[model samples]
Target: NNRFTERNRCPADIEKNLEYITLIWLDENIDDSNESVQMQRLLYKMNNYVLLYTDPHLCIDYIKTIVDENIILIICASLHELVLPIIHSLNTVRAVFLTCNDHLKLTSVCSEYPKVAAICTDQQQLIKSIHGTIQSMSNQTMSFTLFDSNKQNSTRDSASILWYRLLIDILKTLPHTDQSKNEMLDKCAEFYRFNEAELQKIDMFRTSYTASKAIEWYTSECFLYKLLNKALRTEDIDLLYVFRFYIIDLYSQLELEHHKQFRINNNWDKLIVAISWASNFKR
Candidate 1:
């Protein structure tokens, strides 16, 4: 159900656009005689793309090839060992490295090769950076949980809680202006999954459960819309009515002009329909 996993599948246009010139650097020693290699060879042969794999010891030679061809290289190894050689070789080509390390060494490496663009890291940093950037754009201050070693929790649970807290903190900083509220609401809808426990913990909802609680606590229908939409997508009927009531309330309060403005700005039919229904809701 993770939208991220679905979004990362390489599109056909990407292959077509880079078909003639792209090269994929893979670790050949992974399984020289396996179906994976055979399929890779077939792709290379059909598309005239380049594929190379070398032993960890012979990585320097591969680096030389990468530099000589000015090829976009993707290194399939720990960045601690590969960063030095890659920096030595390619002066201008783009590179992506897959790593599990928490060290920010890749940022330093990117500084050496300004052309060497993306350094894909673990999911935690990626999420944090994205949330940080969005909040910064709005000139809002938000705090994130720093998972120091002394925390009394399992690593997995701690990481999850940290991310959840970071997201909640960022949401709290969004401005009360309709434009800002709507933008934040849409973003929350896109990136977050709502849970009752998480909602109850917000300061605005600490008192009671009512239609007003959702709007007062969450600030906008966008979050409610997203929550209901997600619940519907997952067929979670139990939480549907809470979100449904909020959406109906938001629609009733907005003027016709406000609805038009929202539609023009967002261009999302689902949101438009939700707003319309809420605006026209009767007792």
Candidate 2:
């Protein structure tokens, strides 16, 4: 499923904590009374929301003044490309939910910015995506609060603490090289050497995924062979084991594609060699 958000409903606390949400309705005139009723229903569900009906020609002038933080930007599809420059300028926009059906246009925009959280096919999906994104942001805020509270009593050295902070930031941003991963592991070793108890401090941050899982994601995406070679050269058996499953999964996917092509042309020789190459990692 290409689900933009979780299937689970938002918790009550997050709903109560919502500060403000902004909706930019681009249509200057709505002739249908039923559509107005639907708009009212959506507005009623949102918290402390400000609905701005903008003339398509004048949206640029009005959007310049909106500077609120933690904002969920809901805009009409017609204004998708027009508002992108404004969206780029506004760092306060946490996520974007669009009332758009132009799949190609949506794809192009999302490719440019992963922050375009969801493009709603209909009004119902738009509301759900906004609620989900808000809840996710709220949960992240709560986690940051708890993470800060837990570190209040920490007595680790400044160097170790700095590395720990840097490592967490790197993990959040991801796509770092194997060399960077090795550097992060070295920092962790330094942290452990200074005070073994400090290692437990990362438990809260790892709630999303263990370091192994993060490494698995990285190796699967790019540099799989290079990383495997680096792990062997560095005698990083732990890193090698962490990556084994990802390597195996990649080989399986590749082998399937190769087999399908071979079957079409009845090329038994190439298929045998490819299968043999994939199986060597099993040892």
Return the top candidate by TM-score: 2
Candidate 2: the clashing residue pairs are none
lDDT of 2: 0.46
Across residues 7-73, which tens digit of lDDT does each residue of candidate 2 receive? 1222221221112334444444432467754664465445333334445445444445544335666
Task: Give per-model TM-scores.
Answer: 0.26, 0.40
Which digits, one per residue and each the tens of the lDDT, describe model 1 over residues 79-111?
335545544455534344433344365567667
Q: Top lDDT: which candidate number?
A: 2
lDDT of each: 0.38, 0.46
After superposition on all CA atoms, how large is the RMSD of candidate 2? 19.5
